[model samples]
Target: MGKAAERFVVEGLVEQTPAGPRLIGSRCRGCGTTYFPQKASCPNPACTDKAPVAALLPDQGTLYSYTVQRYQPPPLFRMDGWEPYLLGLVDMGDGLQVMGMLTGVKEQEVRIGMTLQLVTEPLYCDDDGTAVLTYKFTPAGTAL
Candidate 1:
């Protein structure tokens, strides 16, 4: 059989874990602040700390805010099938708030403060037929 066609949408952002897929981030060693996409150095202007440690964020969070994008995005962003989708920011209960696409829930069905969990799905297939996986948030306990 041919090898499974799979790849991450963005490297070093999400990782497979024993529990499941988890978002990867960096934590500021000086002030205990964490950020997604893994900041190279502390963003805080007041803090002089330059060191950050790799941190894995919780898969679950609350829907803090959201917006629906109905139009096709600009260049470099692939859209195999253009359709409106929910884009939201989730409060990870720490000081970090992560932004990602929302899936598996209708726009009308979404509610503020809704419990959500992280999921990885194919964003698109490349020319070689490798699936590019990206992280998304979904209403907790809603079947895949």
Candidate 2:
């Protein structure tokens, strides 16, 4: 879990799973609304119980939607300069929608239903030279 922890958890920690690593989310045992990395407060109005039990989310999924960011995004990240990046909404089969960049997808090839796996990538930097790693997606395999 060396690299896995480095990517998933900044402290290089991991909550091991038989499937793989994942950021644990909370499930509303009362309303059935699932959240990623879990929510301390329940989004459901019907259930006031903020007791969000931690649950590991599914990692595999098909691309639900996608886009390309061709400009510099905002700060609070380790990114600057102009570059084209792929953005997408991934459906991990459990109704979970996750957003990330395509680390594994090179230019010239991106499509809907492109299978993907989650990966953490360098966001951007300020003047301090600290790298901000954020969760991003990559092509499940060679997209060629």
* Best model number under lDDT: 1
Q: Write the per-residue lDDT of candidate 2 for residues 23-60, one digit (tens) a residue.
A: 55678887777787657788777886666787766666
- In the predicted model 1, the residue pairs found to clash are none
Clashes of 1: 0
Candidate 2 global CA lDDT score: 0.65
For all candidates in order, the CA lDDT equals 0.87, 0.65
lDDT of 1 by residue, 52-103 (tens): 8889999899999999988879967775676889999999977788899999
Model 1 has an lDDT value of 0.87
